[model samples]
Target chain A: MSNIQAYLRPDSLEGALALLAEHQERARPLAGGTSLIFSHPPRVEVLVDLAGAGLDHVEHAETGGVDIGSMTSCSHLATALRGRQLDKSALTDALATLYTPVLRNHITVGGNCVMVYGWSHLPVTMWALDARFMVVSHKAKPRDVDADTFFERHPLRWLGAGELLTQITVKSPAEGSGSAFLKFGRDKSDEGIASVAVSLRLQDEKVASARLVVGSTRPMPQKLDDVAALVVGKRPSKEVFAEAGEAAAKAVVASDNYLGSADYRRHIVASLVRDALAKATQRAGGAA
Target chain B: MKIRLQINGNTRELETTPTRTLLDVLRDAGYYGVKRGCEEGTCGSCVVLMDGEPHMACLIFAPAAVGKAITTIEDPDGDRPHAILRALADAGAVQCGYCIPGMALSAKALLDATPDPNEEEIRGAMEGHLCRCTGYVKQVEAIKRAAELMREEASHE
Candidate 1:
């Protein structure tokens, strides 16, 4: 006799979302079930199946960006993102470097976003692109929220109780914009000790816009606005790159096992920031 | 929970739990071809094709796989057959049989999707599946050869 009391395969997104709302207390939605099933929840009564809900897609929208379905697996997204979704390539390539082919095939893009504790590059890369998620609830309609605020958890707040994230949308970066993502780890499979994603919009070889995000250092991966500000309106020379790195290193904070002392993490921040900046600049056609 | 899944073209119903790893389940089925190198999902020994994608059976809960099809080395040529074994053998990539199944399956899955994988794509696809014997040189060659073989075969059609 097993305790997995029920399994429901909803045929549509709304049906699955409705089931999620109805059974939020006892049931956990399983997309690929790569992470949820591992929790060994105190109560294992139900597995709400989202696989059949027609959400596993990566479609090009008419407006030029991509509409990524919630059920899209990391490996699948990585493949689709290769030459087509270059703006989000940092996230996709990072996904390619995850543990092994096995886990990537099973891990859902939505589940990866929900597991955005810092070891992941998906959330940070998406955040750098200003991507937004469409979350639905027991309420009337689906709503959109920015990546930064969607995952921020307060001290005692258990948020997202009734919401189910549906789709992720990322607009295409301008032709002059470029991005790069890098992750450092103690071992190949060890969760990233430090990760950064840099997005830059260049104007005549000068950084008209820039965003630098760091993960695996704090409770959440966030943009170091100061670092971006340091590079904005400046040509991406070695000096500018070094300054951006230093500014990013200064922003490293303490949280969740970042593999070393705050000072060491800062050093990594500086090094990877420089590396990411140089690469992104080159991707934007700036001379390295 | 007793569920039926097609393991390498063979169907059987087995009692399992969400905590029961695919490695443990496959071991019971006598498919020793699927290695159990790392239980933490780092090693590719526990790799298997679940509905056309290579996956770590260790990370997947068994009951959640109600009607899915699983393919081990036993199902060679079932999903992306010739990409790894044939092309890799043509390229002399088999150093130790230990990592071959996982490597082969990984290569098979990648070449199935993109038959023209470059060096970086090959490295990205085979990131954590370690082959201590060949130093990855031969494995890279094997993937390339496998892609060529796949394309050659596809062109025949």
Candidate 2:
């Protein structure tokens, strides 16, 4: 049985934050309720439901990007992105490949981002895309944190007692730029063993800038700066991508687990990075 | 906590704990068609439609289902078995029958949203269900047959 003793449904974001402030560590905000169902902490005695808080929305940001409310479900986000044709098909693909259709309907962006799991997909995708997170507290003004800083450590460290994530803004992809995400799992429906996300821009048939992130095999998603630097001035080619993959494999520190050994995961990561880079380069109007 | 849930087009007020799952509550309330398999969310045996979208009932807290309309395998099509159920029977898709109820509900939701789903879409809709009895080939064929039956029934109307 759960240790929960109170259920409070707040009609607004302010109301929800106030409740969290009052209850402190004993209260948890429930959005989609997928993760809370499995692991309800013993210290939690109150659940502040966010369903009625009017936070589920996907809107165009003033900065030309899309501002997604934290409560937006994965299925809803996929539909919105597909309908808008926002050049975020990579994100939609990642969401589709994360879990089954039913689970996707109930898992929200906020819950998935806040609850950092090893196999989490969105953090890696967001980090590669250079997205920004909007976090709000009851007593202070809202603050924006870039994906690099937010995911630098466990996201929970950035979130204080009375603070919660409210929105995520993804900058629109530049012209001649494209992104792709790939996850290697035991099966299509299982959690990923290794995943890679690549975003790159092409200029004069050469790689102008690139951002590559690897996750699912590490404790948290991390940017491969050395690997990305290798492709800064080189043209998109099979040899270049393969070399970048080899550098990535050597850079990451993988450990042995029940699913696979450290060497095996490194091999999988190398292959996934190569494939994702090829796809992103193709989308960026480069001949690879 | 006393909560009201709209199940099968009827609103019922029930007294339950805040931590109880919708699957356990509905089963105890005599809606036995909701099968209980893996208590975890991985298995699809406890799937139920909430607000016309299929979700694992075991993953939903009872009080959290206050305002949404819940649908079960029992009486999904008013008086007759749904087209998906008939198609499954016709295609011999049921072997052990443990996963049928959840699969049927998931199929109904899929067809409700998309009337003419293709083979890939059918397989994607039923990916959460794990059936050890018969291989998934028959179930995919059954969903295709169900789509045909539904289209035919709609055209007649």
Candidate 3:
């Protein structure tokens, strides 16, 4: 039996935030708790649950973006997004393909970003979309932190305190921008050996820019800025797109090499990057 | 870890560890319909509806689910009455009968949400629940028949 003495379920954000502000050292907001409860340090005294707080909706903002509440479940995303005007269906598909129906229902979007599991698909997918999260703590008000920059800065680590991740906002894709996510796993439907998330925008069918993020390949998903610049303003035919995929694989190889041989990761990267780019291009094309 | 929870429409308080799973709680409370075939989440024999959504009971922490509503196969009414119990018997989907309860309940979750679920929806909802005896072909057929029957009932209403 856990020695935990008191468990509090707070209903209002202000009340929860006030409690967190007072007990910043010992307080941690619990969502889904798929990983937090099982893999936490032994010093936890108070478990503040956010399940009853009613922060669980996917609201399309009036300003051309979406503010997905931190507690949104992956299974709900899979079921509701079947015919929605989501800019990234491959990312949606990758989420739907998570392990099994049961786990997907329990995992929350906010926890996916905070824990940032190596096996998680959302981090890889959102990385390419230039997603940002709303980080809120009682000590400080709320602030919007860019997803990539926040990881690099390690703001959460610097503070040495738990910050509640309140929301994730992804801007509506531009006219030419298209995004896709893919993973090639050893098990037929299990976690991936390696995965890639790609986003592209073109001007006159010539690649204007691309954002490529590869997953389970390093400490975290690697951003392929150099590889993306290589194909900008170039017409991406089947051959050209294959070259771009090879460039992405090569760039990943140059960065932190995977546990697998450099050649094996490159081979898998080559295929996934190619498929993701092709799918994104088709999505961007839009039969116009 | 003495935890109080509402299980199967009744409040039963039990002592368990933070690590002790909801599967342990239900079984100790005599709700053995929540089978423990595979302690790991891979086997869906422990599938139950937490707050009306089908979830794997083995993976849930007893403390985490303290206040949430949990429904086992014993939760009465709906298609579980006519569709699952009736269809499983008619189509021979209950071989050893170990997997029938979960398969039936998971189908109840699906068919209740969608009165006329297609083959793909039923198959997707039944991903980890396995029946080594039925070969699953007849089980899928049975679930499809259940959906059709539910649809007919919906249409008549």
Candidate 4:
């Protein structure tokens, strides 16, 4: 049962933060309310709803990137990106594969980032895209943290008593860059058993830089740096991609769960990474 | 807490707790058309339209829906069943009928947003719903037919 005693919807971010500070740990910020509805955490006494805070906007940044408010719903983001014909990006692929249209309408970017579930897709995709999270608090000016640093530890640990994530800034993909996200599950709607995201940039038919992140097989998504190093400076080829996949299989700490064995998950990670590399490379104007 | 909700285009005031879901409140207010299957959000049996978008009522707190237009399976068009409902019946899509209310509401929302949705669009819109009978092919076909019927009605208008 929900332990909630008060529901406060403040019209401003400062007001919401003040309410959270006053209530301390007893209050939790409610964005889309999907996670709260699902978990119903027992410790929550007051709910400071962020709906009226006006955080759900998507704007094109001056740097040619996108500044997405934390409260933007998945469907809204998909529509915005699709309008720009960014349908081939990894973020869209991940959003399209998220639960369903109904749930996607209510699932916000902030909720997905703050809640940090192992099977969550956005974090892995964001990490690969080199996104940055903007966080604000009552005591200090807003600070931006790179995705690599944000996902290095539990993101919740970075928040203080009254801090809230404000927006996510995804830098525009560089020239000759392409990214792809893939999830493997028992069924289309089921939570992913193994997921992989690859973002790479090509330079004169050689891999200039790459980011490889894997999710769902472990407690949190992790970047395979060693595997990425193997692909850097190398031409995109089936043999090179296969070697990178083998390296990824050994790099990840795949766990055994009710869904599959650790061995099976590792195999999936290898195959998905290889295929994702091929697709991303092809999009990067490389022969794969 | 007292909250005012616009249900099926009618404003209604109700006394509810902060934690009770919209599904519980609506059903208690005699909106039996909002079926209760899985209390969790996955089943989509308790779906309703909030501001013309399909949302699982079980996952929404009653207070959160205070200012939105809430549409249940009980048609606002009075006694006449919605065209989506009629099409489902005509297509034999309602076997046990447990999932029809939510399914029809989803179909109606889809057709409202997209007057002429293709087969894939219909399937994508109805993917959240789980039905034990009819094998979902009939439901997809019914949505297609419903879209056709809606388009024809629009032509007359």
Interface RMSD of each: 3.4, 1.1, 2.8, 1.2
Candidates sorted by DockQ, descending order?
A: 2, 4, 3, 1
Off by over 4 Å in 4: A62-64, B76-79
Question: Tens digit of lDDT per residue, candidate 3, span A26-59?
Answer: 7667777667546654666666778776768887
lDDT of 3 by residue, B86-106 (tens): 777889888788887778878
lDDT of 1 by residue, B1-157 (tens): 5768788778888876645667787878788888989776777877888877788877776765667878788677756555578767777777677888888777777887888999988987787687778788888988888788778888998
In lDDT terms, which candidate is top? Answer: 4
lDDT of each: 0.75, 0.87, 0.75, 0.88
Off by over 4 Å in 2: A61-64
Per-residue lDDT of A1-288 in model 2, one digit per residue for the tens?
A: 467899999889999999999998899889888778888588999999999888899997544468899999988888878755455445765887878888898889877888767677888888888889999989889999998889888887768877889998888778888889999888886777888989999999999999999988866877898899999899999999999999999987777777788899899999988888899998888977
- The fnat scores of all predictions, in order, read 0.58, 0.89, 0.39, 0.76
Residue A149, model 2: Cα distance from true site in angstroms:
1.1
Residue A165 error for model 4, in Å? 0.7
Write the candidate numbers in order of decreasing lDDT: 4, 2, 1, 3
Per-prediction DockQ scores? 0.45, 0.83, 0.46, 0.79
**Which 10 successive residues of model 1 chain B have the least lDDT summed?**
B74-83
Give the alpha carbon lDDT tens digit for every residue of B9-50 in model 4.
Answer: 899999888878999999999999899998888888999998
Residue A174's lDDT in candidate 1: 78
CAPRI-style quality class for the chain A–B interface of candidate 3: acceptable
Candidate 1 lDDT by residue in tens digits, A1-288: 145677777777778778877877666777877666456666656777888778789987655578889899887887677667464456654675565556777878777777665566678787777788887777667788786676554211433555667788877767788888887778655677788888888997789998888887875787788879998998888888998888787776745453777677778888888988888888877866
Q: Pairs clashing in candidate 3?
A: none
**DockQ of candidate 1, scored on C-alphas against the true complex (2 decimals):** 0.45
RMSD of each: 3.7, 1.5, 3.2, 1.4
